[model samples]
Target: MMTTIVDLMVFIIGASIGSFLNVLIDRLPKEENINGRSHCDHCGK
Candidate 1:
């Protein structure tokens, strides 16, 4: 039971990190600001 909980936590952390990196990779090339709040490109709200 303890091992399963640890494995789940590790998976969640790894996935979160991967998603953040993916965002950086997609945005950096377009010269977008990563610090600001994210919004839709079509509406520009």
Candidate 2:
């Protein structure tokens, strides 16, 4: 039980990180400073 819970937490954390990276990748080309704070792909920050 504990191992499964820990594994699930790890998966959740990894998924969250992947999601953030996906947002950055989707936005970096047009509307963001890649080294700076994140914002939507269609808007500048």
Candidate 3:
């Protein structure tokens, strides 16, 4: 039971990190300023 709980915690942490990275990947190409708010490359809003 303890092993299963540990595994679940690890899985949740990994998934959360993966999702955050995905957002960066999606916005990187379009956004010029990575440090600031994520927006479109063309609009530059």
Per-prediction RMSD in angstroms?
Answer: 1.2, 3.1, 3.4
After superposition, candidate 3 runs with Cα above 4 Å error = 32-45
Q: Which segments of candidate 2 are over 4 A away from where they belong?
A: 33-45
- The local lDDT score (0 to 100) that residue 1 gets in candidate 1 is 100
Which parts of model 1 have CA positions greater than 4 angstroms off? none
By descending TM-score, how would the candidates be arranged? Answer: 1, 3, 2
Tell me the lDDT of candidate 1: 0.89
TM-scores of all candidate predictions against the true structure: 0.77, 0.65, 0.66
- In candidate 1, residue 37 scores what lDDT? 77
> What are the per-model numbers of colliding residue pairs?
0, 0, 0
- Please write out the lDDT profile of model 3 over residues 1-45, one tens digit for every residue: 999999999999999999878888876786644466656557867
lDDT of 1 by residue, 1-45 (tens): 999999999999999999889889978998998777777878978
lDDT of each: 0.89, 0.78, 0.79
Q: Is candidate 1 or candidate 2 better by lDDT?
A: 1
Over 1-45, each residue of candidate 2 has an lDDT whose tens digit, in order, gives: 999999999999999999889878876666755576655545744
Residue pairs in steric clash, candidate 3?
A: none
